[model samples]
Target: MSIAELQLPPSALHGKKRVLTSAFVGTTVEWYDFYLYGTAAALIFNTQFFPAGSDVAGTLGAFATFAVGFLARPAGGIIAGHLGDRIGRKSLLVVSLITMGAASTAIGLLPNYATIGVFAVIGLVLLRLLQGLACGAEWGGSALLSVEHAPSRLRGFFGSFTQVGSAAGMLLATGSFAVAQALTTDEQFQAFGWRLPFLASAVLVVVGIYIRLGVEDAPAFRKLKVENRIAKAPVWEVLRYHKRALLVTIGLRLAQPALFAILAIYLINYLAARRDDTTSGVTAVLIGSAVGLASGPLWGWASDKWGRRNIALVAIAGIGLFIWPFFWFLDNGPLALLPIAMLLGMNILHDAIYGPQAAWFAEQFPVHVRYTGVSLGCQIGTVLSGGLTPVIAASLLLAGNNTPWLICAYISGLAVLSFIAALAAKDPVGDRLRDSDAHDEFEVAP
Candidate 1:
């Protein structure tokens, strides 16, 4: 409830800090692995791996891989969520980091269409799915680890790091690519430069494992284990007992991921389609992403102070209001840097809402089923909002109509729905974290 109340008496800060560090650093690396693939998709995958008869076909193929990750996310979430609840959050985080890093490393070494024929495409898809699965599990574990260890008053600020890591990872991914592009000739860069980022993941993975090993389980979870309150089937129980929370999680995710995909991944493609060269487009996005790295944490900090629901409501309203203007700046081309900066800033606003989301989501469930509920809710968000929105946006754009306002409206509308959901949610503030038996559910915190 208050900072002093949750301080762990200073004696426990040493252990708690270790967990927080692990969560933040591990998530940063995990995101780096995932975002590296996104950079490749936007810049080089079509030409290197999924070359088609034409540019459009090539672009479609690239996006197909990007979307593949989204589609596979739910399965990953379900499996990893169950494992996290049953075992420990730290173990799942380790597995996810290794899996994502290995998959990403493999992507760096993958033979292209030229070297391996169609297998290149197949191999890439498999690897992408692995990344997706790993990513799906990564969020729940990281958020819980941080929040569980955090002072209750600071849950929003610390919880924000998980998402902050996401933005930082994207920034790292994009920035690395941009640097690579600058150093190499177009010929050489396309020939091999893309692989550097993927290969670098191995180092990050090793570091994540090392850090996770040193961290202890959350105090809440430890108490649950001591009390014999672990759920029998967290996944099933979550579905059977907390259907309402699940639905709310799904709806909230739609706005966050869809808007994110539109602005971050799809915007580059959209810009490229509008202009012959996309160097400027990529640069604008890179700047925006760098800004996100900072904004995400700031948003998380705000959420902790003001309440997750209140912050989310404001952010959703802001993004809905800003969508048309953001696109208008892009339509006006590279000259609209100030407006574009503001557009990118709008996402930061979203991040403020999104930063505390994991803790907010997890707070709804008992410790035993927390992973399943949070993971399922997030994955559904990924599938519906994150995974599909880019494809949908692409289709909308291709229909000879470019009305960003409509897209903005759709994103804002979902946010409004989530706002209502938030308004109705039982707030968990001031409650000590509790464990649940298979049939034992916490009173939905309000």
Candidate 2:
């Protein structure tokens, strides 16, 4: 069959911009909710939500709640991916948005440890788990929504809309908190000011849901339905048939999330608690995230030229080599210049991996189980590297006598693994949208 046969019909592709917009807006809200918690875990949760303890122990405890979300990510991917693969991507996307918004709003309203004691921590953990689940489910659906609607030649570029949204959400999360912190005294900020960002998620969620409700499911999923090719158990099918691809996807995803955990989340706490600087990197993180927003599409465009793996390898290698130097600039800089280092290290270098990631993973699996495959692989990878990174970084910093060497080495090591995974994984750059075993199941009937 001609490759053109797999393409979205021209009329469907006519809505391409809307598809990208929908993907971008929905993720902005979802990630805003998710990232807000991570920012809070670093800045507020340790101080406000948990019981009194030493700095490291308290930070670790707060991060434990952060990790809860990562732990639950795989389950989110499994359930949402199954439903997305079977029913439609649009439905799962909407539900995940609502789930995330509700969780973020609840966390904003929850009493701190001072008010409710142990139950507050328990409430926080449960809500964090919901956020994690929603995040795990949201990425794959938004990615597929954009990539599946894109022209074959520009799939990488279009897939980047999701990453752009992710960056926007991070910017919003950091910037919002920065504003709140700037506006309040430290005492007042700790007392109640931190809740504003979480509560703000409710408004963003309403906008996101209204936007997403107007979107149609990706054409690929619709085609699957018409051909009756949807897998009855997509999660199982992905594990059974695509194990190697799944493993590669997980490894390929590790470096970026781990980098952010260190640069954005861990560093926030590390600087604030260890260096007595709470506001040092927040602006830099926001700036870096903004850079990521502009450059994500550029990397996606590069992937279209050079292939996804090629672009990813360059990024991974860049981050690995730059880690020590990056931290040196960050550690020694005056408060005014630290974000510049972050801007170069994070927005420019790390984004190389993130830019092409969604399309790269989507093309690795066929339509039938693509959502499950991509979501499960990413969630698994995140739980391993992204989720535990803050805890690990905190321990390493303390173990290494408050130096960045151990943390730099840790991130560099993950980058090496990422490079190896990219080298070993197949690059399906020119393949039709995907390859699915469901084709076999359909051959007898379609």
Candidate 3:
């Protein structure tokens, strides 16, 4: 069908810009909440929450809590996907934002290990789990909200607003930490300055919720409701009938999330361990995320022009080729080169995949189960890669005598997996506007 033929009613399309803005703002807030924990885990969680060990052991302990959030994500994805598929995307987006903001703000109020003993650690883990669940639920709904509301030809560009939110979140996250560090003495920063970012999430969440409430659900979903075509068991339907779509989505997702966890989270501590300075790493990430915020939409536009799978393959290849040099710049190059490494690794390579991913994954499943399928696939990949990569990389660093060769090899292996999966994916942008119930199964490569 031609793009014009598939356009929704003028009323349904009237809020397209508003929907995109809400998706971006909601996700930015959600990610800001999520990344706050990661930045803290890297910089101070060990001393504040798990204070009883040697530096390496304490770092490991802190990262384990970081991974705990990943462990809860699939549950969040499953619940959100099921409810989103049955109810509507807008409501879930709103709920995820509220839950994330509350959990993050609560973390700011949590007592430290010295003050409350092991309960402080226990409380931190519980709140982190909530953050993970909220994050898990947030992405699919946000992505679909943008893609489904967009005209077929502009889906990539619109869907990219969701990805851009992640970059923006990271930028806000790193910037908040940098500013906090600058404003406080080391002892004061360790004691109280770290809580400021988490507390700030409360304000952002209110803004996000207001914007989301003002917008309507996607027209595609409204049509599904009008026609009574919502899936009775979306999670089951996806698992039983769309296994290939699930596999392909997971595969295509592996590299970027893992690479991001490494560069944005783990590397902060790694660089700090080497130079005893966290500021430079945070600054590099801040610059890289700014670059990513600009690059994300362009990459999404490229996917619209060039094809999603093709752009994804090129990005996967770039990650594979750049892993070694990314580390080289951090380890051997001058201080000036740190931001360049972050820019190339994060904005250039990672955003290339992330920008195209929402529309591509959404296209892989029928709308009836799009939320469930994308959430399950994407979150599973996250748990396996991004969630665990920091812990695994840390262990490997210790084993390799602090060399990054093992981590480099690990990321390269995932890149190859993603490339093969991207090759198997069928670009279905042309058919995205089709009626969801008419095509219940994905059109996969034979």
Candidate 4:
């Protein structure tokens, strides 16, 4: 081989690292901004800004605000996909980071129910919607930045970094809440300590934007541009041609967000309602998230070797079997077992699906419209699962007098549905995404 060819491989490998790291940090910032609200909503928002009535009503209100973010995610995804496909991934990622961080910081500054009454609630909902839109745009861009920049052989390993950001962000958000709680009395925490986590997102956003600005668009996207392969209305193109793949992606995605909502967000409320506290659940989740953050890349690497379909299928099944055991550990715990169940739920069972999702989802569409196709499908799933999950779990608990069996069944049903969808969808392991036949036929708009 020529010396030029030898030099080419190492240079390309180094570039992939730069792109993947930018994607990782930017995604981490977005998720940190997003998950902080989930924690705040569960821990304090209901009492702070919502229409006050009962604890249940307040929680429902807080979570309804949470759902509003998910409601706006599709629009964000559609807009980002359109722009990112034509303009570039790096720019949109920076825009998304700033937008998400600013919204979160504004939430930290907003007045609450005691000061402004219903206007406080309205402001909170609007900010939450803004957060949703920014986040919806963020997920696909960051994930694609990593996956598209990566070599096909290592796409899962590289793509996994975006998933790592999710777990890391959850870890950061949960750990911050734990620290804030420890530093303050319950009343002080409820009054003002909660804002610290939201405020911290500004620092993350700054770092994310700096890093993202240093990177270029992925190789595939650049190639698409060079070939004049950009789609004019990519969302409509996906809807007309690749709708089945989009639907399957949505179905497979439902379980992960629902599981996260139940175990991460709802469990805080569950523990609070059951024992009048969230500290243990927070502690367990903090530990679980840290473990998952570390393990995501390993799972991503494994997906490259083991196949995304096989790994997802097994993990979903594992999640089903572990559901009752998970709650049992929380319910009958000697306290030490609490983290074990959470570790299994978040790090092991959940990461199996999440770690490879970036590569898996990206592979479903062609380079010309990949961002729009993947973003639309994944954000729709988020709206369905993440938005309403805590509300559904909370309602079930209220109906069953706090019995968790019914709630567990609801989550298990989603897992089963997810498994079936994965079974039906094609695995794109080593599939050259740039060569998608489905998109090759569509001519670029004039």
Q: Output the TM-score of candidate 3.
A: 0.93
Q: Say which prediction, candidate 2 or candidate 4, comes out ahead on lDDT.
A: 2
Each candidate's lDDT (Cα)? 0.75, 0.84, 0.87, 0.83
Error in Å for residue 12 of model 3:
13
Give the root-mean-square deviation of each candidate in angstroms: 4.5, 4.9, 4.5, 4.5
- Give candidate 3's error at residue 416 in angstroms: 1.1
Residue by residue across 293-402, what tens digits does model 1's lDDT show?
66766666666555667677777666666666767776774554643554454456567667778678876777778888889988888787778776666666655465
In model 2, the runs with Cα more than 4 Å from the true position are 1-13, 430-446
Query: Cα deviation of 432 in candidate 4 (Å)?
Result: 11
Clash totals in order: 5, 0, 0, 0
Which scores greater on lDDT, model 1 or model 2? Answer: 2
TM-score per prediction, in order, is 0.90, 0.92, 0.93, 0.92
**Reference-based lDDT, residue 300, model 3:** 80
Task: Point to the candidate with the largest TM-score.
Answer: 3
Residue 18 deviation, candidate 3, in Å?
A: 0.7
lDDT tens digits by residue: candidate 2, 116-228: 89999999999999998899899999999988887766777788889889889999999999999889998999888999999998899989998888889866678779888
lDDT of 2: 0.84
Q: What's the true lDDT of residue 258 in model 3?
A: 93
